[model samples]
Target: MSLFWKESDERGHPSLGTVMRGVVLLAFLLGGWLPSSWANQVWEFVDGEGVTHIGNVPPSAATRGVIWLSRVPPASVVKGKDRGPSALQFPGYDDVKQHLEAAAVAQSLDPAFVIAVAAAESAFNVKAVSRKGALGLMQVMPATAERYGVAARPSSDGEHAAMEPKVNAQIGTRYLADLLRMFDGDKELALAAYNAGEGAVIKYGRRIPPYPETQQYVEKVMRFYRGLLR
Candidate 1:
């Protein structure tokens, strides 16, 4: 399962500065960054030992110790609610980019594609738990993990195993690759299968299922995937 790995000191990895820049750029795209038209308010606040969370929708009411980072134009609320952990939870791309790249490459997937999926699924929250019992960075269900041979161990239970960032990335990307193959390399169909189910995709004659969430998920991830590659 440990494939597509590079040395920790691998040359040519993007620098921290580059990662930060990329994070901001990706955040802008995801959060609907407007140019010369308006500014979105991403509130920043510190908690327990100075961990700061910058969020378009602040965790709570803004008060002292809450800060906002503005870039040109007047501050305004950004449209759309974000998934758990939000975009700002990722302080920089460096935090998760390498894992995304490694897992994607391991599964013969485009790194940006994997990243886009992760962005949509959990927003890089390694501990994210969905209401439907999906868990971890990739929001992997324990059953899915079992099917993929990365099922959680009995000692740690399936939940904790899926919570591991690297494990989740690997298993999740592998599952995505499986979906792609099942759909004959059609990314849209593959994504639909990933979000909805292989059964749903097939029931719909290999077209993206008509479910609103699945359709929106496919489009959003594709947008990020294409934008990042460009």
Candidate 2:
């Protein structure tokens, strides 16, 4: 049986608190366990019947839109002691924000999602390099950069062209957009492919790989993306 409640044809309605608890219970059943992070926020999405579902975890496929419920309050409410901080911000973000935005627009992807990946991958550091040789702001690998038509330029300092903010952002966003398409717009699966390679995702039945690093990478990027949407 479906764990969620369908709206009644009559006027009867459950309390909001009851509805929320039901969603949390559903989350537990679906995930087999609830992470502590799930307690900090919840999301809402509407079903085909126009019944809204609220839960800590979004469905793998959201035909409608997912709405984040934990955004910071309006400016008028800032004087309150319980005020929450604004969306996620990274150091040096302003320097490369334009590049990320442009790349996202070109790829028909969410600017916030692109920025979140950059934040989680390199904290907006254009010179950042991973031990595995992922390069630049988005930590894109050399081969992936080439596939997107971004070539490494010969330099005396040995800095690849991918280290340039604009080139890196463009290549990274394109690669991510391709992944999203490949995975049928499933953000988690696309992100898994980003972290662990598309081969790994396909090998695992198009699910996020079992690798802890890839799992954590997806969670971190999603957290940043949600915060940015807030």
Predictions: Cα RMSD each: 12.9, 16.3
Per-residue alpha-carbon lDDT of model 2 for 1-230, expressed as tens digits? 12233321111112122122222323322322335655444433334454644454434543333332221122122344333223344456889999999999999999989988887666677777654577878888888888977778999999988889999999999999999999999999988888778888999899988775577567657766766765
Tens-digit lDDT string for candidate 1 (37-126): 333343333333323233443233323333223221112223552222222234435677788889999888888789878865655666
Task: Tell me the deviation in Å of residue 230 in model 2.
Answer: 1.0
- In lDDT terms, which candidate is top? 2
Colliding pairs, model 1: none
Which residue pairs collide, candidate 2? Answer: none
Error of 1 at 162 (Å): 1.2
Residue runs of model 1 more than 4 Å from their true location after superposition: 1-92, 154-159
True-vs-predicted CA distance for residue 119, candidate 2, Å: 0.5
